[model samples]
Target: MKETGQFEVYVEVLRAVIIAVIFLFLLWSDRKNDLKSWDGWRYILNGFFFLTFATTIDITDNYPSLSKFYIIGPTVLEAILEKIVGYLLGSILLALGFFKFVPLIADYRREAEARRKAEEFSKNILSSVDEGFIIIDENYRILSANRAFLESAGVEFTEAVGKKCYAVSHHSEKPCYESGEECAVMHTFQTGKPHNVLHKHISSDGSPYYVEIKSYPFSRENGRVKSVIEVLNDVTEKRQLEEQLAHSQKLEAVGQLAGGIAHDFNNIVTAIMGYAKLIKKKNASIEEAKKYAEQILLVAEKANSLTKSLLIFSRKGTLEVMPISVNDIILGMSELFRVVVGRKIELETDLLDEDIMIMADKGQIEQILLNLISNAKDAMPKGGKIKIKTAFAKLGETFIKVHNLEPAERYALITVSDEGEGMDDETKARIFEPFFTTKPVGKGTGLGLSMVYGIVKQHKGYIKVESKKGIGSKFYIYFPETNEMPIGMDDSTDKFFSGNGEKILLAEDDNHIRRLMENCLTDYGYKVVVASNGNEAVKVFCENDDIELAVIDYIMPEKDGLEASKEIKKINPNVKILFLSGFSDNNIEREINDEIKNAELLTKPILPERLLNKVREILSKEKELTSLDSDKLH
Candidate 1:
């Protein structure tokens, strides 16, 4: 019995040692993990307590005297009872630990996987964004940058990391705050609030671009600003498009203004030219009287030219491009410009001695001149000198680049300078913008420079302006030079073409213009029947069967020239019709029907001589046709 009890004690000792060893191994394995967790440590503690209890029962069973000294129960019963309690406690602890730790481990694994996916998603969002994005720490050091930011900075990710934000964007050694430039990121970091700013960034290629920067603050839980997230949007093209739209609107406004005044001005010019021509023709025998009449004719022609310039400036006239002498235009306008600038202002010219030819509309070129002179006159409110100069320029690559001109071209340069209050840089930049003016309301239309700019562009030319605030302003206009010969003036006007006693119908809207036309035509020996408008012209044509031809003004109250011509053609198919317009040929073509045959179109303020010659030519053609028809009848 003694031997058996000793063997049992040894077996219990071995069992206790095995349990202790297994529990210790579990603790060691979980040491690197969250062993502080009750689930991990409680199982080991329970197993240790159970091992202690079992070993105590085993030693007591072997020595009954020690058991009696420690407890009043029988050794065998105490040992069995202890074993059952300890085993139950150990099993419960092990089961509780397994249940708690299994779910906790699964949750931990799931959380780790989700965190990884979130990081990947954030990276994808940053990479796919179109605008440049960057993250910088409070110290302005770049912590992270997206692909767009990397490209905009002209650097790789490796190079951008750890660099200063200002160094990367502004190419500076210090922060933008130190340089006096408003830094959105720095502000965001300092105030822990969002900030926005517009910055002009110089690219690596030495070109400048505009960007709108919006920055958001990244803060800690305690509301301490940790970093800033910057969003950069390029806005250069958007700003340019806005400027272009504004310019177009201004041009349209000015064009409308020009169109409104065109008809009345053309009528006045027609009356003046007609009366002057009649005076010159009637006084040809008196040399002095003829000379005075010729001067009146010259002034009338200049007025007519001015009217044409207004039409061109309004973009309401067709371009009549031909080789023209620039000097003649400038010299002819010299007296008018002097008068316009007033006696306070002195007008001077430095024209090229030799003629400089250019392929351009004569009226459009004159418009350019008039606009520039008018602008100069306005600049000098008090009294100043206005200088008009002309020179031939050979433009090369360097010159073209500096002046923003076409490459490898020759230009006829006309410079108009003023000794007046000049403009600042900002004002000079927008001088050619339509409706942009420094002059007060009603004092200026702000369309002069804009019209000049449009006319120059239409003629395939360029304008450059130089101004100093207190000094003066200078405008340089460059027209592409031409080698083609200019058209010679017609001296046929020295002799008048007298009309035979042929019945003619005339239509005019203006009373003065109509009376002048009647006197001129009657003096030339044509029996003239006058009408006030297109409807009257049609009526006159139907009532007067012997009328050889009809002259109709394009724009009238009741019916336009085109409608009257159509009606007259129906009444007399063989009658000759001459259509006169104050507007451009393009506008007339668009208004007139294409079916009207044996019809002629002329632009007004027509010279009296040209009118008579056209009438005579058309009448002769009609007579020839009539004679052909007569011979056919015979």
Candidate 2:
């Protein structure tokens, strides 16, 4: 019995010792660790101490004296006392500590999960964006950057953040603006508004490229900008494309001009060459020589006209402003256009009664008309009427707003209408685009309307087109009216001047110039008897006895004007004579002054109105003298 009791006490002491050692170790660890601030851990520490105390009491109870120390009359009260003071109390304290601690642990887990989700969302957004995005603080330090920004900067994210932007991107020691470079971030910070600009950047291959930067201010407080968000888009390819297109357009324009010149000059050269060969023939007679010479002169006139036309081919880059009447240009081209439209098409004009004038480049205006007319002709491969009209207009507020024009009140509107195969909506929309055309490939430059558009805009004007497929198209061009007039201009300058029905002999040595003169006179209602040279003038003069006047050129092939006029005078002393000279050749001017009695010499390059007015003045004076002599005889 005694040995069994001692063995039981030894087992109890061992168990108590193990429990107490665990409690002391736990307390020592908690005190040394960072977990000392944890109230839950502190609660557990108090519970452990109680457990250890209860275990000690159990160990002591193993002794017979301690076991019955609380017993009374063998009622077994010692067991109850043990339960109340040790095991029961210790179990309650442990339960209470666990109950207070579990919720704190759960809260810590939820917070960690939320932070992980937020970081993931931010990383996804940074990776998905295409443009380089960077957040910069006021100190020029890079706070954060997306994947694109890091790649464009040629730096890793780990190497980029917390570094100066200039140091990382530009490899400069100081800020970008300090080196006289434009900084979008600086602009955003200074203005507290969005900033956009084009910047030159270096690529990874060490080549230069362009980038467009759009930066916006963010985190603003108290009217102060705290940070900026920069967005960078590389525009190198787009810029190169634009430059190439402009170059191509220029080349196309030059090609078109060259083609036109080659066609016209070829005809002029052929005629001149052929006539010169004929004149060089060994068996050619004086008359044949004169005839061929006249033909050569005519070719020369055509060349001169072509040269004058070339003067109008100024580039849109410059302007030569002049006050010109559109009606006059229309009227002057009327005879030529009849042949130009190919006999099938009818040309009609409805000009404003006032002979409206507009401020414009004369050559560009001519080009506009020619292009419209040619397009009209092409539209009607079968047959159609092309009508041109000019009217004065007052652009209202609505029109000014729609066209985005300068605040101008009056404008001249020109409309070219064609009854031909019209264009659909898609065609109309793209007609003015450079290199856009409906013509067959290799047939046209397709730059006509596009150039026309550019010229109108260059002059601060506007153009509009209305069309329907299979119906027709009308191009409306508006030019702002200017009050300023060029010097030496008349309200009625007769670029299309005409004459009375007077019978006259027209003589010239230059065939083309003579032809030009004849065309003008015949169109003006004059009875023109044409002569190629001085001898021809004299012969034609005698053939028409009733020819009222003799118009002569001083320089000619066989017989000169001074000699011819002498012969004509012998035929009829009362005959009137007018001499047209390109210039006063000293010898001819001297001879003409000495020999001719009441003849008037007019200079070359004379305006049509000047020529007609001079001829009329001479003829009117002759009639006045005839009337006076007849009155005296009566």
Candidate 3:
């Protein structure tokens, strides 16, 4: 609205100032770009600068006092040149600059959009997962965390980001490695590969829980791990469930075994009762009574054998573990094997020439052969070849995993192959299950193979079977090999059973067995002193200075055989001990093998002659026991 000359001059000066500001801003924006890409920015900036200079010259033309320039010419002379060079040239440069910049702007917009969407997609996926996911840099700093991770950590995004990953997840001042916990993330960074491990982590609420932590590493151009992505899965419930299932299966198996044992005992009792009645009713002669008595003793021995079998199957009894040759057991059972298989079947043995010795129960090993051969004989009613082989095996990775055995180098492999009716995959899979058998209900107790399995497992051995429906079956048993020499099989001895008036202290809780043993020892020219319990036995041994031997039962009411033996040895380390046990505990067996150097273990229900022979053996081995004491002292 102002028509004054002064107002017009002020408006022109303001327009030139605005153009000059725009030119400076454009040059600042192009500073970050490459020199080659500066062509478009150069044009736009120069246009603004020219336009501003031309307007300035025009504004100066209003004031004729100060209208001069060095880069151009006098204000009056450049008035025409200002329109051509400043306005026209500036407009042309801006038009060309915008033309070149158009495609560049469009490309920037498209690339920016693609990156944003990719980030959004990744966020959605991580947030939706149930497992906690996080990306952490090599410095242990948390770069990014998903919604799942934030919630699990019981913290907000502000609380977690940029903080050390161990600080958030472990709630610790130091890394997991410092706390004796192997950090999967750190392991991956160092190894340059994925790592997984079981980790105990603290939740946001500070409760401890177990997680399976999986970590992956990302490398840079220099092949160094730059960052790690970790996924955490809680597995606390799965491990608990597995333990409960195993316990339940064990209880069920015990119940089934008890029932089977009860039924078998009832059959044995009936036989004994029938034989007793026959002997009582027989009035023919002393010879007839003697024959009936022998029959009764034979049936009673069967009951004792049954008791031993029960002990082995239940895995509660002790094993007289000794280094025994596998070839010897197989050969020893050959006669019994032939009788059981009959003339219709052919039995062959392929034993290794080199002795393969393992620490195991000799009787248990014999039982294994008997059970397997019996199983094979039953499978082939029409008679077939049964082959037993023994060898030294390496027990490599595959064998160890298949049998779930501890990693070891040497194993004694015993293979029993039968050319008989075999089992299918389904039947073979559960063959080791207790109370599982293909035989008819009344035909088999289903405990034979199970007993073998229990014995093998108790020995820290493994058994596996391969079978085909119409073909045949092969069973492989592996026992850890030992360097110890095989036990001597020689039964002949020159030592006499009768003692030379040597005093013996016999301790047994059983009235009948103890009295019989005392009389048996006394009759053999030995002075026998008896004690009812282990406490009394210890007292009597202390009273009698000339007691040559102390025989005590393994399991007693007040004090056990092991304890009494320890006390006796403390008094006289040179005295020999003979331990008799009806129900031998595994701990006692281990003590006899390891700590008790002056003692020998003898299983109970032993014949009177055998008991006398054992006492004589221990008494005669005084020099031997003294030698052991000297060796142990050294």
Among these predictions, the greatest TM-score belongs to: 3
lDDT of each: 0.80, 0.78, 0.81
RMSD of each: 18.4, 19.4, 10.5
Candidate 2 local Cα displacement, residue 266, angstroms: 4.1
Off by over 4 Å in 3: 1-130, 133-190, 193-196, 199-210, 218-230, 256-266, 269-421, 424-468, 471-547, 552-564, 579-596, 603-607, 623-634
For model 2, residues 397-477, the per-residue Cα lDDT tens digits are 888878876456778889999999999988999998766888875567676787788777766789999998999999999
Off by over 4 Å in 2: 1-115, 124-133, 146-159, 202-206, 232-325, 358-364, 397-412, 454-462, 478-634
Q: If scored against the real structure, what TM-score would every candidate get?
A: 0.52, 0.51, 0.56
Residues 111-170, candidate 1: write the lDDT tens digits: 999999999998998888879998888788999899999987889999998999888887
TM-score of 1: 0.52
Query: What C-alpha lDDT, on a 0 to 100 scale, does residue 267 get in candidate 2?
Result: 93
Superposed by TM-score, candidate 2 places the C-alpha of residue 305 at a distance from the truth, in angstroms, of 8.4
Among these predictions, the greatest lDDT belongs to 3
Candidate 1 deviation (Cα RMSD): 18.4
